[model samples]
Target: MTARWKPNVTVAAVIERQGRYLLVEEQCPDGLRLNNPAGHLDPGESPAAGCARETLEETAHHFVPTALVGIYMARTLQPLEGQSEDVTYLRFAFTGTLGEFDASRTLDDGIVRTLWMTIEEIRASVERHRSPLLLQCVEDHAEGRRHPLELLHVDPSVAGAP
Candidate 1:
């Protein structure tokens, strides 16, 4: 059997405060780009947990996911030096409360800094975004299309079952 195709599962936190969104400036495979606090879902953790963890790791802030913005399937051309592939991503985005940061904490590798930028600013920097979903999540958030947390139910009998 050709290896079963399984796209990496990622979780992103759309943390907004005042009138700006929290963004992480990191060095992706493409280049130095902007993206929400997002990361691959770790084993034995729910999407919410992953979002919280990624936010803390990238921005040194605690994020409490309040609502699911929406799910997205985005396919794009991926070019690596010379080897390119068509990659599809399944992203779970959540909007929530952005708590205080831990100044003592160290940011993850490749993460240069975090910034709070207005949606317009983000839009202007679309060319620098690591992925297209970076702005899509923000747009969906601005539209107020959120699903309740209850939309995801983890069965107690099985670990990592949602």
Candidate 2:
């Protein structure tokens, strides 16, 4: 029997302050790359909650997701060890308010540091991005493409209720 295919699910926080957007520099298989503060969605948590958690882990800043920016899907060949495999990612992008930074926290593995970049700078660094969605999410947020957070309904069963 063939194995079932499942797209990896992730959540990202598109945080803007003044005229810059928050981004993370992380180590990737190809090299260092920039991306929105994002990570895989954890089990038993809503996408917004996952975004908040990933933002804190990657940027050491508290994030409160206010709106859903957009959902994106992309497929790529990811290198693992000496082999490459096709991978599909389903990402939930969100716009939100950034709160206080925690100086005592350490960033997640592979995450080097967080920085703020203008849209122009981001546009110029497309080749250095982890994925194209990095710029797309920021552009969507800049264009005021937002949907109410109420659009996502997390049923209790997501927490493993019987």
lDDT of 1 by residue, 1-162 (tens): 698888868999998888899999998777899999998988888888899999999999998999999988888888778888878888999998888889999999999999999999999998999889999999989888899989988566435455
Per-residue accuracy of model 2 over 1-162 as CA lDDT, tens digit each: 999999999999999989999999999999999999999999999999999999999999999999999999999888899999898999999998999999999999999999999999999999999987899899999999999999999998998975
Error of 2 at 77 (Å): 1.0
Clashing pairs in 1: none
Query: Can you give the TM-score per candidate against the true fold?
Result: 0.92, 0.97
Whole-model lDDT values for every prediction: 0.89, 0.94
Error of 2 at 38 (Å): 0.3
In model 2, the runs with Cα more than 4 Å from the true position are: none
